[model samples]
Target: MGLGDFADKAKDAVNSDKGEEVSDNAFDKGSDKLNDATGGKFEDQIDKGKDAADDHVGNE
Candidate 1:
């Protein structure tokens, strides 16, 4: 498959229930790591980013 085809398949997978669960878990873990690394100084921004990512991935 070409790049566009691969992207479409990935998007489809991410829009599924199981994929959303995995995506949320990954985002939570990543956000926690970033918060820890930054001593929670950028927690708000991190959360905003996570929200935006979730919206992009059609989590809700």
Candidate 2:
């Protein structure tokens, strides 16, 4: 498949219930890791970024 087709499929998958769950878990883990690595120094920024990402992927 072409890049556009792949992207469309990916978008569809991410809009599914299972995909939203998976995406939420991944975002939580990744944000937690970043917070830990930075000693929570940038927790606010990281959370904002995480929220934006979740919204972009239609998680909520």
Question: Cα RMSD (Å) per model?
Answer: 1.7, 1.8
Which parts of model 2 have CA positions greater than 4 angstroms off? 1-4
Model 1: lowest-lDDT 10 consecutive positions? 51-60
Native-referenced Cα lDDT, model 1: 0.90
**lDDT string, candidate 2, 1-60, tens digits:** 999999989888888899999999999999999999999999999999999999888544
- Model 1 misplaced regions, further than 4 Å: 1-3
Cα lDDT of model 1 by residue, 3-54, tens digit: 9999989888888998999999999999999999999999999999998898
Number of colliding residue pairs in model 2: 0
Clashing pairs in 2: none
Clashing pairs in 1: none
Which numbered prediction scores highest in TM-score against the true structure? 2
